[model samples]
Target: MRLIIGGGTLAGKPQLLFIHGIGSARTSDVELREWSTSLANGARAAGHADLVSGLTQSWAAETRFANYSDLFYRADAQGAADGISEEELPLLLALLEEMTQELGHQAELAGDRRSGDIIDSARAQIRAAVEPDAVQGQGLFAVVRRAGNAVTTLLQLPGLRQASQWTSGVQLLPVLSQVGRYLARKEPDDAGQGLDVRIRERVLSGLDPSRPLIVISHSLGTVVAYEALHMYTGRVPLWITLGSPLAMGALVLQRLAPRPPQTPAGVERWLNFWDRDDIVVARPRLERWMEANALGVVPVTARADTHGLWTHTATKYLAHKDVAGPVAETLKNL
Candidate 1:
């Protein structure tokens, strides 16, 4: 069984597990469960008074999708609802239904499945990505809007563009280190084996060893995944990122792990995927990931649908059309 949102897919039978990284306050695992199934949001603060019809989208931008039409339709908050607000959920679901029908038709023409398959796909992935008790692992999209904080630095904002991080949210380095270890196990060798030992001690202790693992990260989550792989000397399968912050300090984890060509054994294999013109993870990505290629790092680029829009509502089409291909193929092979 599989969940096939526009470009993303998640296994259903013997559900595949996913875990979302930390985000805003007032979020919890309970909320995430509900949101994942519904594909809703809690954004009461999206625009407030700042939303502009003309500015909602910029045509001149380079993106993965044709436009925001795909975004609005795929707006179901069907993942984690940890940081979303109470008022924003319903609106998100409406968008999901709209997007599914539209994309399903498009996908059919492209030789995928019927329109109904969109909903089925979304349903499967939502359930598999999140644990009934754990909410979810990482996802293909992430939302980052700092009304007046440093989070907006990637783009130009008034006070927000220049301010330093004020929120005590999840830091980047620790998260990346954690994810890298998971992917590192895909390869087999001394470094990979040793890293797996540490990962087992840290995360895999309770995990059912045979259960298939899939990691989908966005923004900072991407950075977390990268650092983890690098720290462990590269080994992961199905690594996906949207609007990643790979250049950031924490995600980079400079020299934390040893140089390449000397990787250890028993590490996991990998497939690193990202978007271009993601605002958060724009250029210079080729160069960075290229360095890891020597240590068995395999990276792929998944173009975005719209410029700088990091949320599911914005990138769902790309997730299914552009991003899900390699992921589904790899999972089948595994």
Candidate 2:
């Protein structure tokens, strides 16, 4: 949103690109501007004063926001303008159902009745979240209410939560379900909603291939960014992901373009930041599942700004030194 282009050239300065994830249709240019400001302020807070002023003077305007939420929202715009659509509910419900079913099946297979009960409880909560009267379409308040209801329901499922931590593959079910829904959602052909192609195209269009790239993506945007890297034959010197779910295992990783390599192609370094309390990022140590050395997970303290899963917010993710450190490193390299 803050495009300060065409100034004196800062040769070899990596362009910083921000790609937002889901539930971001309402995000305003002001919020994006604030995020860029925070990154600069964060850099200063992290004792990178030289990097801060160097970036501000040399390439302040080079940062770009690859906003795709409006495009994503348009695809599922059948409900109240401020709330999740009626059509979206079914798709989301299906994901929740599938997750519960998978967990239930796994519990059954393991002869864990306790976990099965928890799965059933989770299923009920998912059902409750989409019920006809589950969420009043009053306004943003209602949307918050609906999300709160769903989150509360899930949080109460101790069995499912316990089993997920104890079981190797179970923790991935919820993460997979969310990723599955994003990948499977149907949009009008002209809407350009598919992640690997359409969304990736939107992300790539804002990129300047010649410049070194430092990609900062949040949530589902990380998925799209990763795909775009595989499709585009350009170099990304730094790939930073905030609250990404890409480490959720086979359901997501195995299906990635370039087929889940040790490190993404064209990416010299990858820094993934995750808050332990952020529900969106199920697994953060991507290197454990993939290759080593290139990818590192930096855990940050989650801020409980509000109830529910807002811990995944970009503002909180961007406020940390762990995140700013990598950006400083990229700028220092330049």
TM-score, each model?
Answer: 0.38, 0.66
Candidate 2 on 1-334: residue-level lDDT in tens?
Answer: 1323457564554688888876534454665676676677668867876556544443543677786665543434444323444444444455445445654665577687875676577667566656666555444335334443444444444322333232322223333233554565455355554534666667788577777778888888888787777666667777888877676555456656666445665787777777644545555656566553244322222322222234556767776766776687666665
Error of 2 at 258 (Å): 3.4
Per-residue C-alpha lDDT of model 1 across residues 267-323, encoded as one tens digit per residue: 244433443322223232433433445446445454444333333222332223344
- lDDT value, residue 163 of candidate 1: 28
How accurate locally, in lDDT, is each candidate? Answer: 0.32, 0.59
Top-scoring candidate (TM-score): 2
Give candidate 1 misplaced runs (Cα > 4 Å).
1-22, 26-205, 210-212, 227-236, 249-277, 282-295, 307-318
